[model samples]
Target: MWKRGVVIPGARMQRALEHPGTRRFSLTLLAGSDAAMRVQDEILLARLYNELVVAGRIHKTTRRNRFKGLDRIIVEVLGRELPDVPEIALHDVGASSGVTTLELWKTLLSVRPGRAHASDYYANMLLVRCEGHPLVVACDEEGAPLQFTLGEFVFSAGQRESLFRPCNRWLQARARARLPDVARVIAARKEGRTLPSGWSVEVVALWHPACRLAAAADARFTLGRHDVCAVMSPRWHFVRAMNVLNPGYFSPERQREAVRALAGSLLPGGLLLIGRTREEADSSNVATLFRASSAGLEAILDLRGGAENKELVLEAGKRS
Candidate 1:
């Protein structure tokens, strides 16, 4: 579902739908490629690096390759479960536009059976006064809800702004990184060489913290370290595979204790599939969380493609 040039819903749209408090909204598909078209204010950059698939800039199968990695992690998780799971809830933290969600559903449903839910904080639901009172509406253009309002969930613009800030900031930073290159590409358009498209740019712009936090909240509340933290970058996307930098602990001091906690929570033969960066300094507080949840190391994959900046994949499992 998330091939390189395919236009999917942007993160903002995903937020509007996944947020529990939202109610009504409508959409009409645009012409041309999805990445080539979008609202002016909501421009999205795709994550892949391709001059053109048909023109032979690079292998057209890059998109499929990324999804293959995602499938590997999913299969690994299922393989380690005691007797095969009838349903599995995949938590894609920092899910932007639910692209990963669509891909996961397509893959897992074909083989294993289960539910896949992607999450992002609700952004479009707004609270306002009508005539002389307060009301809530599911809206997009800041004017009004098209035809409906639903439920009793109350929300304020301030809350929406707060929840949306982190992801917005992340995108803004990527846009900044991309602007100069885009300008040059566009300036050279006299020969018909132009930049990929708004959405195409975004796919590459996605980085670790920004993209992950965008979908982070989607996972259910209960997570145990040994539970096999399956993570994938999906091909053409910037991330390689998810990694747990220090396994269960990021620092020397907490390493052993964190490993213990992770081991205690995991069922026998449980696993962790992580996505991380090859960049030397890439680290985070998640070490505390993973350390408390994971068991001893099992297998690890260095999925980096010799790219200067890329994420890595790390796996840990509870011994039987």
Candidate 2:
């Protein structure tokens, strides 16, 4: 049976960071280095976020410029539909890592200025202090740790040299087998019971520094944790949900519930954008822009092709 690598002491890692010679060496082991955390480097940020996604086994995945062409068209429609509106309140549901949310916000600014709120089901990162060994964890909306892994960072001397190696099928299988222990550790922490030496865990926010900076620097951009299936108060003038409501991810009933919630969140006459992108090199998008009304959602624009589940959206709208 494969075993988890021994955990290196957090005190030792801290000491390594304090020294000039070892600082660079220590930084190499971290998922997010000090410089990478402080700066807004898109490529570096995406890589760091992807690491968490893989380790946590979270299904939410997104990429930069994934909706490039579609976003411009959506903005154009907004300009024409809500012409006299000075400012639009926009909300992007299931905005993983929020990199693309910023992209859409910048595009919206070209035509009109608005406040943009980016939300996701798993929006928070947990910095788990395990005994003296530090582990970074990603959490669900309820603040429970999604998953944990020894492979997330260089937690032991054995991992230091092999850290950069690709995790093959065998390694992934072993990681999956070890999840029970990860859960045990989390439970012990939550119950306030004493953990075995080197196994004790403490959790805290490790929110990406770039996300914090973006929200602070721009009054218009904000981030939050939200589940798409949950009902929300009507507030936003425009809501965008991309690559989230999929037939593969949710049952038809659940999709209808999510659509109802999304529709209910829109202000009267507000617009709702729903779509998916093909994984082809061109990243072609199939989407529909809907005008929310008391009667139901009226499809105003179809890009490339209408949304794959456009009928489900319309059906949900009718019942809403």
Candidate 3:
């Protein structure tokens, strides 16, 4: 079974800084949901204190705002090709409040409608919440594209008054009909009789095309202190700020350097998504200007301690 949210203890975080491996961080726009936004704030604040003040880092001035780029990158990546049977993880480097942890879970469940695999190494905890019955049908890769896809789906929580309110409508009658089958699917996964190693699949109604298109673009530009409410989602897992700080203002040269650093921390097949403005549109050309910054660097630094080398996703780089 894949490990879920695990928050690093303060002592461990400190020890990690001393480790030789690269550190990962990310900055992206705030989520589009209320729960996600609230959670992100708490996570960002906590990271700022632990990473900046405690560690005496330089980007202290905008530590709280650095995650914007990471945010945009991740949103853009997922937006481009959301996993139908996807396994997503976000490392919260400066996760003081752990709000980012909570929001990540909410978004996975609410927005795309699927089961989530979460891990919070820092907290040393893992949880799997099954919402709206998820059906997992399998197939050989060559047989039928893994028998699952990453996209939006309709859900039906049954009760007219649901915890998700109207959004619960994302649930569908089909899901309700398959409730029995979905139960079996869940049971099989837990017993390791169905799901493959590190894989989960759920069927959901098609996600809104507009939202899909927007997700394709860099999402970091939309996140801000006032836009924290945008982070909410039903997918529950160990979520946190992409990185502790946003590097939107760094110079082109520095931004590229930061991206290199962040990319070093990601795991194999892992992603570092974030938002950033076009350089040509940037007027001041200040290293700290959000409009003209490198999304890759910002996202990498925000991730909590872990395997620092996996892959990188930048606006300047390929969206895939």
Candidate 4:
């Protein structure tokens, strides 16, 4: 099934698999995959974060509090305004790592046969060639995959000072060193390859606890890849586009197109909730609700802990 962190074969991977020339390619990268992790074959920062979680520096629970205000908006505004609503057909788009939808099933699915669906564009299947990366296989002198056990490595000042260490640990540490310069590395790649700054990391998976729990909780909670301006599903009662259609990531025209699609994806009298989370998982988020009507997607309410809705209304007016 579509389990988060567990990638299933998709169009990108299928294309690679069907081709004869570059068939060794495997994997569809996670949506918005960290650029730093693509340089080397290890996710050092993620590992460090995982370490923090283990040490109690980080807590790994579904931060359901983020959606509390959105929930209120749903019940008070849409539930009351609609007057004749029977069920809610909802979609949470741009749901990064599925973290925003965690613990949502309790209120969404279990509440007397509720109807809602979620969406996200997971980084596409990532294709990794195992030959270059030593961790995936053990090669003999002739460079053939061989039977293996624990892998060893040497980490020290020099040939004389080198100390033996486990290969996995060394790789993990090597990954951390590249974190600070990753943004620069991405810029360099975009400009040109002639510059000397070149390194890569490989992310085989994204470990999202929220998505996993949601998938296991109910089969109705669908997970799939969707670009905001190009979602090809039928109309929904409500669509929540969070942290996706910001001006920084998309140009004005592109943002307008995305807004058009979001509005079009809603049924008449349906609600469209849009927002961006500012800091950590705090409630310092900015959200606005627009209800689809004959006048087009009309801004109906400015949500709590959200920015002024005038800005949202202005944007919608420009598009309208």
Write down the lDDT that model 2 would get.
Answer: 0.65
For 1-320, candidate 2 gives per-residue lDDT tens digits of 23332123256444543442311122122334354355354443443444444223334457777888777887888888888888989999888777678888889998787889999876654434445433433333233444444443322212232334445334544544544555666666567776645663333223446556789898889998788899999998899988788676778998999999999999888999988877654678888899988797888888887899999999888842
Model 1, range 171-197, lDDT digits (tens) per residue? 334333433443443344324564444
lDDT of 2 at 261: 93
lDDT scores of the candidates, listed in order: 0.31, 0.65, 0.31, 0.48
> Compared with the true structure, what per-residue lDDT tens digits does model 3 show for residues 171-211?
33333444454345456655759643344433221112222
Instruction: Note each model's CA RMSD in angstroms.
Output: 18.9, 7.3, 21.0, 14.5
For candidate 2, give the lDDT of residue 281. Answer: 47
**Error in Å for residue 201 of model 2:** 4.9
Error of 2 at 159 (Å): 20
Which predicted model would earn the best lDDT?
A: 2
Measure candidate 2: CA RMSD: 7.3
User: What does the lDDT come to for candidate 1?
Assistant: 0.31
> Taking the tens digit of each residue's C-alpha lDDT, what string does model 4 give over 71-102?
65565565576656666667777664454554
TM-score of each: 0.31, 0.73, 0.26, 0.55
Better by TM-score, candidate 4 or 3: 4
